[model samples]
Structures are given as structure tokens and as C-alpha cells.
Target: MLTQTLPTWLPRLSFAPVNTAPRGDTLVVVFLRGAADVLNMVVPHGEDAYYQLRPSLGIARPDDSKTKKEERTVDLDGFFGLHPNMSPLLEAWQSEQLAIIHACGAPDESRSHFKAMELMERGVDDERGPASGWIGRHLATLNTGNSSPLRAVGMGTRPQRSLSGSVPVSALRSITDFHLGGDLRALQQMRAALETVYAGDILGQETLSIMDTLQKLDVQNYQSPITNYPDTEFGLALKQTAMLIKAEVGLEVSAIDLGGWDTHFAQGSSAGIMPNLMKDLAEGLAAFHADMADHQNQLTTVTMSEFGRRASENGSLGTDHGHGSMMMVSAAMWTAAKSTGSGLGWRKVNSLGQVIWRSQQIIVMCFPRF
Candidate 1:
């Protein structure tokens, strides 16, 4: 259950958000905090160079007879394969609900975790750019009639920099914390007082409305009837986000974090530390996909990392920070090229830094229903 207690007086800075129909699907951005190894995550098994460089760390080919099932890659397109632990997503892959964008990343070329993440989150080429995030700008500009105070949410302690624009975003931890002392009379009295104090302000009204919205939800006790979600922090976050969406609380975008991808030490190839991380990720995602089965076409979940680790495994058995990154979109409405699997055109490149990281359309391109 959600445990953190946040003040209901979270800040917001915005003018009137034009009330209109939804512009698109609810977008959930899952940020893998530490630089993730996209090469390993989305294994390029057909590329011999991948195995040549990191023989010890590369996942075994799908057809490798001697490799354990847990160590072998789950064939996607013969060329690209998902790490074995991520096999749970095969449902989405085969169902054509998952689109993998390879080698997409910030062109800043900074390997420092903090700098790279800042640049990526801000959607800037370098440090001398706008402080607000791309998503922030999107929400600010789009006159989608989503007026729910919980419209844009940062799922943890602080809002992600990408959600740092002018349109008000709520930095929240738990919906349960807003239960208002668990005393109905006190809650009514407090609500009356707050309504009286914030009577004429738009932001205040929105804030009060958000409280009212959350008050009706039972998020902390939510349990998906169809999916047995993993009991991890990431899983719980996704679970609660699903609850908010189902409650129709006007949650447009949510930024959830799953850190510790900086596998500089003991970055397991198929069965160790890295695979464990992938298991947690895959299980949570699969469960979310199942739990939200009813709202398939209305939601889009995307995964990203600050940057990708080096292609070749280092002497320390882990990869170094590099520019190779990939993005994944799991949506029932994937409208991009019917990618049968090839790493070019709609691709993003190897962390080896040899291939040019050319850009291409991903989000809106695939968001046709939106």
C-alpha cells in the first residue's frame, strides 16, 4: 500500500486550462533512473558483435541448446530478443501492443548520471536550455479538458524534471494519506473551511476538487482482480496509478521511477543481479497490462533511461555510462510502421557510439487514437 504522507497543499502555477475533450491516451512514463543497459535489456542476439564484445555478459541466443531457459534470450524478431526475465512481455509483443525503439537518447554525450538525466528530462541539448520538461510544455500548451487536479502527477518524493513546466503538476506519494484524519465530521468541517478560504481562486478550487476526487478513491486497498501484481515498490506504484485511472480522476500523465540500473558491478548476463531487476520490471509491467486490460486502447506506457551503458562489458563485469538508449511503448494502439523487427529507420543505435543516433517520431506517431 502507498505509505508516504504528502501535504494536500501541493503547489501549482497555471492559468485557465481550456476544458476540452481528451487529446490522447493517458501516458505513463517509467524512468529507469540509473543508466540502463539497453543493449542487454533488448538483446541484439543476431548481431554477432554484441556477443563478441561481452561474451560473459551477453544473453545467450534463443536457440542455444545448452543455455538455461533463464539465460537465453526470448526471440522477438530473430534479430532483437528480450532478456529472458522479460519474457512476460511476450504477450504484448506478440499481440502487437509493444513497440521497441532502439538507440534513442540525448545527443549531449555527457556520461555523468546527473547531467545526462537533467538534459534528457528537460528535453534540452545541453545545460543552457529551458528548465521545464517536454511533457510539462505539452500539458501547458494542450487545451485538453482535463481539469482534475490530479491531472499530471509525479509518483514519488519529487516531480520529475520533465514534468516541471508551468501547468500545475502534483508531487504526490500516497492517495491514502489524503483520507483527512479518518473522521467524517472533521473532514467535512475542514473541507468547508478550505472551500471558504479558497472560494474565488481557480487554483484553489482545482486543489479542493482534487482533494474531493482522491477522497472518493480507495487506492491504498486496491487489488486487481485479474492480475497478481508483484509486491515491489515499482509494482505498487503501477497498481496505484491504475487505480487512479480507473477512478476517472483525470490523471493524464504519471512519472514513475525504478532506479538501481547503474549496474557497474556484477551486472548479471541472464541469471544474476541485472536479470533480477528485469524480473521486477517485467512482472510489474505484465501485471499492469493485464490489470488494465479493459482500458487497453486508452493507455500508453513508455519506458526510458537517462542513457545506456557501454556496449562492451567493462573489466568490472558491468558496462559504463554511454549514449545508447532505447524507448519502449506498450499501447494497444501502436500505429508506427508495422515493425517486423529491424534496428534501423524507426531505431535509436548501439551504445558503442559508432552508429549515429538519428532521431525519429515515436510518441505521437504511434498515438493515432490520441
Candidate 2:
């Protein structure tokens, strides 16, 4: 068999070394690819305008007779209810770690996915802008002397554009698949060769540091012994992230993108595409939360989409892309007192009120209020 030698610039395990602190603070960014109907996900039942606008697909209020237990939106307070699809997340909200930001969207007016994604990833509103990613810039700011190996990670094969910068960062694929499962001598050779290849490249060096962190975790038997995560892509990805954190790799930030939110056809308000995806999202996130319960303060999860669907349903029994969507931030980092008032308690409202922030700015809400 022909053994393909991985590129010298590509990180293998063992090359870059990082002197990271034990797990401190963690931030998780979830990119819900395609526009999600924010109105449906975080229904403002208090708004008569919302019901009037979305006649067919409007989510029923928790007290409505038409609302089924599973189908009814979880009451955020009394004004808003989570879409039945996102019940799992609602549970987290009840626990005080999950928060929702309503009417949030890219600062730019354009609905173009390419443009929106770029703006979000860059964390900027420049129409003609710099190529560096927003998270990447954040990492650059954190590059203190010791440059920890596992300071940042993106949970996919390709690191999101946000984490692309001059700082060292990594993407975790599979915890098991990432390690070199071979002999000691071969691993040593691979490491020596990699050090030479990444000597000049900054990103390469950072990736090398990530690899070193993974190797150390593998040796520590840090796999989740408590929770049984589902066998799906998102679940596995989250599990891997939890493992990295549990291993005390000093992971500060991570990103994961879940596609299929562009519900053009059977978006399924009662029990369809949106709900199923939300279930997976909720379950996966819940599992991660449970697994890292002890490290709650060290982590935060944020979910966002390019935009929200129209206020009304379309002819296809679904929704079209529209202005303003919802963003959810896990409350893992906030205190109970802070989260209660600061969190967007999914309350019922009487009118389609003006969004609380600048239309051109991205909305970010910390869970648990603190």
C-alpha cells in the first residue's frame, strides 16, 4: 500500500508544543447555516402583530388549547415560547444557562450568504474589508508569552474563517482519529520532520501546538465517562470538544457550524425539519453541558444564523429569508441573579416592537446574565 506522507505544513500530532493553563474560560460559537426563522424559534406570543403576520406558521402560545405538550413552545417567561423543535434548549433555559437575543442579524443589509458569513466570521461590518477572521483577531489579542497549545479550536475538518489569524489555533475532528496510533519511533520521526516544516509558518506553528495538546489529552484517558452522546455528527463533534476541555488543555474558544437550517420546504413547525435539527442541537449541547457540568463557568455556547425567515409563512408551508433572527447564548458563565434579568426570557408580547439594538450590529447575549 502506498503511504501518503501528509504535507509538511499540515499538522500531524507531536510537532508544536504549547504551554497552556488548565481549563479556564471557554466560548462556543454555533453557526446555523442558512437563515432560521427567528420568529418561530423564539415566538413572541405577546405580539398580536406576530400572529397577524405569520398566520399559518405562527407558534402557539403555551396556554393555547391548540398547543400540544411536545409541540407547544417552552415558555420563556409568559411572553415568548421556544419553538417545540427546540425544547431541549428550553430545558437549559429553565435551568438558567441559556439565553436568547431577539431580532439579531448581521450589521449589513445584504442577505447574501457569502457576505453575511464573511461579516460574521470577521466580526465586522466593513463592506470591503480585511481578510482576517473575527475569532482569529480575538486569538491574536490573547497571544501572551506562553502561547498555550489548546487555546482555541474549531470543531470541523476546516477551521471556520473566524478563527483564521496570526495566532495558533486548531480544529478537532475526532478525538480517537486525531492521535497517532503507531509506534513510538515513528511518532518521534514525524514530530522531528514537522518541526522543520512549520519553523517559518505562523499558522502552521499554531496548528502544531494544537496537535501537541491533543496528544497529551489522548494519553490522559479524558474521554467522557458520564454522558452517552448521540452518534451524530454534531454530537460527536461536541463530545470531542468536551474531551479536549476536560483534559485541561486551556481551550478558550471553539466554533461549530450546523447546516440545513435553510428550511425552504417542509420546515415543519409542529414536528418537521426544524424541530428535528433543534432536537439534535439541544441534545448534543445538553450532553456537552452535562459532561462539563463542573466546568460551567469555563464555557459559553452561542448560536446564530445568517438571518431569520419572513414574519409570514410562504406558499410552500415554510418560510423565506427575512430580516432579524434569534441568537441564543448558553448561561454556563453567568450567575443566577444576573441571568434572570438579563436573559431574554421568552415572554409573550403585544406588539412587534423595535429591535433593541442597532440593525447593522450583531447581537450577543450572555447566558445567566452575568
Candidate 3:
């Protein structure tokens, strides 16, 4: 029952030479902890069926001039639009640096939060699958000369299941304190754990140097380019990720979580609870997008959740767990206009179970040859 609390940062620069892992863009994974009503985040205004199914929860169309800006969807591809609170991400979309993939599925069709999140993070469809996460497998299979302890980072009190595997991951509680002066005890403890891969002095020294590099950049006061990152926990996670990317500390991937997405009541169609969640998500991402302008070609940000909401709303004015969620990817490497996926067109099929499969591509694509 422990949790992470956040608004934090640091930065610099270094170009990776040839023959290193993650020659591709650094990956930042933003996971919505609870089952986010993705239908609201990525509005399907063009689909009349969507409106009829959740009339009370349906987002107003882009052309609803009478509606307040926060009451209408921001058109993305004419057919789909973003929730009003997600307006912050529009800039990335306008620049064609963002892609929207609709109707992704969960491994568990049963709609159990614990089950689906576990399977999704572990990158498996069932208990029979490997316990290690997809990112872990990626690191284990690809052996590039890069073995920095900071290679993989999970922002929280614990490393995400997706980060569990043969590879070592630093489950950081504070990005600002990821250095020797801050977590010496933890580092000393890690020394024993990583001694196999990192010779005693090597791990310590490498980590010291990385932190020193970060200290030199004064990451604690990093200046974002396009816009400032919000002072929220989610924003803090991203700011730290941005700092790491800018610092060039050999970071290939980082995972961040944003909770409170289970909107079973007062999910809000135009402005309220859920909209606020959208605001935080969109703002944090927008700020990161702005700060990452220079690193866009070498950075890919993706948002995901456990599952989607039911097409029908409950009497509580909220949504129940169903299936068929969606994911949004922001990257310069992304060229696809928008992924319609496979079964969403029918207006009912909950992806028939394709969420984990398709979303993995975005993650795998981050490592050039991995």
C-alpha cells in the first residue's frame, strides 16, 4: 500500500557512439494506473453510436459551438477528437509528431483490473507466460556494450512488473536523489546485487559519474523549452525523464504511473473529475513534448491503461470496466496517420484481445534492433 509523491527534475548532453544498446529513441512509458475510460480521452465523435451509448457521458462534438471549450472534443482526425482537458497535447498532434491508436485490447477479457494490469505489464496473456516484463526481455536479449546501472529506471517506490526480468532496474523514489550523495545506502546495497555485472568500483563510479553529470547540469532547475512541466506527480515523473534524456545518462527506458482513473462515478462528460485527470495527463505530456522538441527524433512517449470502460454508462453516472482501450504515441519516428487497429469498426467488438500485442510494437520499436 505504499505510494509515490512528486514535481521534480535535472539535465545536460552526450551523444552515444556506435555499437550501443538503444540506438533508437529513449522510451518513456506513462501508465494510467486505474482503468481509464479511454473512450473519453480519445473521443469518437464521428461515431454516432458512441454518442447514443453514453449520452450522459458522451463528449460534445467539435462543432458544438454553443458548448464551452471544455465541453467539446478537440478534433484529431475529423472522426476522433481529444477530450477537452487533453488540449495540452494538441501541439504535438499539430506538428504531426503524435499518433493515436484506437481500440487496443487487454489480455484478460474478464475485465479484472488486477489481472489485466498484471498481464499487460508482464506482457503476457495468462499466468502461463513469463514472469518478466517486455522491457526486461528486451534488455536481456540485447547485449550492447552499454551496462549503466541507470540504463533502466522505474519511477516509484518499486520497479514496475514490466521492468522485472534478468536486467537490473533502479526503482527510484526521487530522481533528484538518484546520485551518491542522496542514496548511498541504497547504492551500497545495490553494489552487492550488481557486482556480477559491475565490478565493485565500476558500478559505484559509473553511477557517481552519471549523477555528477546530472549535478553539473543542475537538473533540479532544468528549463523546459516549449513550456514548463506541471508541478504534479505525473509532471514530476516526466520532468525527471526529460532531465535524464537531456543529461544523456545512458537511459534507454523509464516507466511512470498515474493513478485514480477508475471513474465509476462522476466520470464527467464535459468538465469535472475525469476531465481533471485528462488535464494532468495532457498537461504533463504537453510539457514533456515541449521540452523534448530537440530530442523528438530520439524520443518516443506513449500512454496506456489496463482496460477500457463499458460502452454503456451505469446509473452512478460512471463507467464499469469492459474492454477495448486505446493508446496514444508521440514520436518523430511514428509515420502512421492513425492506427484504426482491427475490430473497433464494428462498434461493439472489444478488440477481440489485441491490446498487449499492438501496444508492444511501440515499446519494441524504441530499441533500434532489439
User: Which model scores highest in TM-score?
Assistant: 1
TM per candidate: 0.84, 0.78, 0.82
- Put down candidate 1 lDDT per residue, 1-370, tens digits, no spaces: 2223422222221323434235335888899989888888888888876787787898899999998876798888878988888889888888888888886777766578898888878877778968998889877877766666678889887888989988888777777664457488887898898889988876677666656656656655566778778888898788878877765557888889999999989998866778889999999999999989888778889899887776678898988776657888898877542333355432335474443223432222123344
**Candidate 3, 180-214: lDDT as tens digits:** 44387886776556555546565555765565565
Report the alpha-carbon TM-score of model 3 versus the true structure.
0.82
lDDT of candidate 3 at residue 305, scale 0 to 100: 85
Name the candidate, 1 or 2, with the larger TM-score value.
Answer: 1
For 1-370, candidate 2 gives per-residue lDDT tens digits of 1123522222233433345543546777888888767777777777676677667677887888866776776777767777776666655776777777676776665767777777777777666667888777766766444465557777788788888888767666765456555689998898888889989876567656656656544422334556667678888778777766655556777788888888778777777788778778878887887777888876778888877666666788787766667777775554441122223323222276422212334545333311
lDDT of 1: 0.75
Indicate the worst ten consecutive residues by lDDT in candidate 1: 6-15
Instruction: Show where candidate 2 strays beyond 4 Å.
Output: 1-18, 143-146, 181-226, 336-370
